[model samples]
Target chain A: MIAFISSFISRVMNTLFKGRKNIKLGLYGPPNGGKTTLANRIAKDWLGEEMGTVSAIPHETREIKIKEQVTIKSGKKELTFNLVDTPGIATKIDYEDFIKHGLSERESKKRAKEATKGVIDAIKWLDNVDAVIVVLDGTKDPFSQVNLTIIGNLAARNTPVLIVCNKVDLKKVKIKKVESAFPQYPVVGISAKFGTRIDEFYEALFTVFR
Target chain B: MLTLEFVPYHEIANLSSIGRIRKLLNIAKQNKIVLLEGRLKKEEEIELIKTTMEEINEDFKGIELAVIYPTKNDSGIFTKMKTNFVDMIAGNRLGLTIIGPASIVKAIKKDPTKIQLYTQELKKKARKKK
Candidate 1:
């Protein structure tokens, strides 16, 4: 009976202490900016979760998609990340999809607007987060307003921004200009679609977080 | 009303690390409107802005926070975060803050005369510097 009790108590303690420390990281960018694709890669490679849906349409993520807990290890350090993937930035949206998805269009629109506000919230989350990953499209001009604004805001918040230049495999994409543009910040060029830079991306995250 | 102009660091030749540091120190000394333009990701820009603000705050008793973006469409997650950070930092201080896009189209849409006057003053200041 004493051995049985000891085994039960040990089981409970093991369950409680087995998990790593959770680090909340938010994936944020403009509409259809490969944010989801990168999120899926991170989730699958680090957390062992199955890949989520990927769509070409903007605002594909109308709500926050969260993967509760996934453990990632770097050397002797272990961290559990509660990765939150947010909706893309959109000035306006179509209500039909929201209704079809079983949510009110009015409410969805409100949520969409709130999603923009979530960017601020995400920055504030930096106070608690270990690091943040900012995804960018390599195919587009790096000097665009959205990219600059996002980078500027992140700078103001004092959050460590890891610029992931995604979609590098595309024929039209060129990383040289992008690399030259933001010399002050660390940037990792990756092709999220084909998982070309997945290893390097993880190494960068570990370096930053560590 | 602190105005900041962000320029790509690589665009400026002979802009060594020390030169950039000197420029920042000068901006701090002048209490002038400063801008930080670069083709950075959201996180990189935010980190730079925050560090610069902290540096400015260290030198000046209560420096205002203002972020100028090139276009209205550029206003997104990062912009919202900037406003929130400004509000947070402004809460205990004198609290002068302005966060918006610096696009001509947006300015004209809101108030052409005000934007024109502002631009005129900037150009005049540039001429004086020249």
Candidate 2:
């Protein structure tokens, strides 16, 4: 009962104050799903600065980083929000997995600890964001547990979501599979690395936020 | 040897979200795959992940979880209504949930109708030479 009341109140508050100030838009997904790459793309496009470093190593962004008051203009329409780039969420975080990426045991343990805390932080932030952008790796299967969990949590909160099928530059990208997997939300295919089809993503953002 | 424990929905129906998460995590830490009769609430699922992360260590890595529920794609109106009625009576007990320790369960591949739980082969420790 309390949870439902709080969720209702938050939705009301979000609706009452939409577009009045910076909308807190969050980037969330599983590990190595290109969330940081998309965050960097959005930050570079609007603020002329990158949000965080991207790496092939999972959990590289082991903290919740934010770029404030980013404004993007499409024709006469303009949208401003605080773009929050969060760590990749995972069901399991093993230090040994980091060792496979060539990190020393000691460094791997430290990274694993930080990554665990990062997942907790990302889940906590779900309550604060008015809207969210779920980034998915287009080359991977979208029906994984992590993806379903993330989408389910968002649905439970009734938070607005835009699914970005990132890494479209790759040859084996399966954007359609992602779309079919999550047909409920709006899915856009884009190469956040090379900035291909980014305009479509920005355009889709309007539909979500509006 | 692998163990699978079946937990009925009534076993956790009255527990709070935190309580439910703790119960499931404790079972996973015991290195057994939990075959729950019904799925958890969405908020409970998030809490379960958070709790699992907090308890991760060398021996207890984490948990891999998946829920298999019936989709309402082609069901008739009466069938949909019957499902909803049962949900109201049984507190949404229309699905199955699986939670296993990450050390033992490599991955859980799930489709709408089936689940493929892949278990990793346990490595044998070397015996000492006298």
Candidate 3:
């Protein structure tokens, strides 16, 4: 009974406030999946800025960065929302792994500790976000537990999700593989680094959120 | 030697989400791979990951988890209804959950009907010549 009432109220609130300036759209995925890169792309496209710095090392964005009051237009419709770029989610964070990437032992340990906290923050943010864009690597297999757990959590929260397959400019990219992996959601392939097929991403974004 | 601990669904069915996650993490921290009879709810799975991240330290790295559930992809309507009935009665126990310490279990590759759980190989230090 309480569940039904809460769900009803949530739907009502979503209907009332969605597409307004207060909406929060979050970017989430596994580590090194180019979430910050896509976030930079979107922010630069509309807000004339970048959200956070991107690096080859994993867990570069170890905090929740938000760009407020960013507005986007598609055709005759325009939507304004806060773009939230969250830290990548990972199941494991070992200090040794960072050392393997050329960091000193102390730096590695520090990064590992921060990365773990970042993941916890990202998961907690699931409750606050109105919608999400799950960024995936097009060159890697998308059938991992991390991907499934992320999508499953979003589904459980009744949050609208759009899957973005990043890195389509690479020679080994396979956007179709990711699309097949998640046939239920709208998958857009774009190289956030090279800005390939990003217009289609914007079009799909409007359609999905509409 | 690897330790695989089998936990039936009923073992955790009565526990709260936090309790269940704690119990599983405790077991995995002991360097034992947990083979649970049923899968956890989506929320619980997320909570488990969150808790695991909080407990990561020098001794305890984290966890590698996987779930294998029976798929009725090509089933007819009658079969679908039967599966639904079973789920309703049994609380969706037609699956397996594997949780292992990241220190021990390297990776868990899962497909629809199979799971390949890779374990880390312990490296031995070189012996000095006498």
Tens digit per residue, CA lDDT, model 1, A7-34: 4434543453355366567776666678
DockQ of each: 0.09, 0.73, 0.78
Best by lDDT: 3
Residue-wise C-alpha lDDT for candidate 1, range B1-130, written one tens digit per residue: 4455544444333464445544543554464444444323344334433333333221232122232333323357897677567646643222211322221111111111122113213554457669
Can you tell me which runs of candidate 3 are displaced by over 4 Å?
A1-19, B72-80, B124-130
Model 3 C-alpha lDDT per residue in residues A74-166, reported as the tens digit of each score: 778777788889999988999998898999999999999999999999999999998889999888778788899999889778787889999
Candidate 1 Cα misplacement greater than 4 A, ranges = A1-20, A74-79, A90-130, B1-130
Residues A1-210 of candidate 2 have per-residue lDDT tens digits of 434533554465458456578678999999888999999999999889898898999999999998999988899877788999999989999998999999999999999999999999999999998788999999987888788888899988888778999889999899878877876677899999999999999887765564
Q: Candidate 3, residue B66: CA error in Å?
A: 0.5
TM-score of 2: 0.91
Q: Report RMSD for candidate 2.
A: 4.7
Q: How should the candidates be ordered by DockQ, best one leading?
A: 3, 2, 1
RMSD of each: 16.9, 4.7, 4.7
- lDDT, candidates in the order shown: 0.53, 0.85, 0.86
Model 3 alpha-carbon miss at residue B113, Å: 2.8
Docking class of 3: medium
- lDDT of the structure predicted as candidate 1: 0.53
Best by DockQ: 3
How many angstroms is residue A152 displaced in model 1 relative to the true structure, after the best TM-score fit?
Answer: 1.9
True contacts kept of each: 0.13, 0.74, 0.83
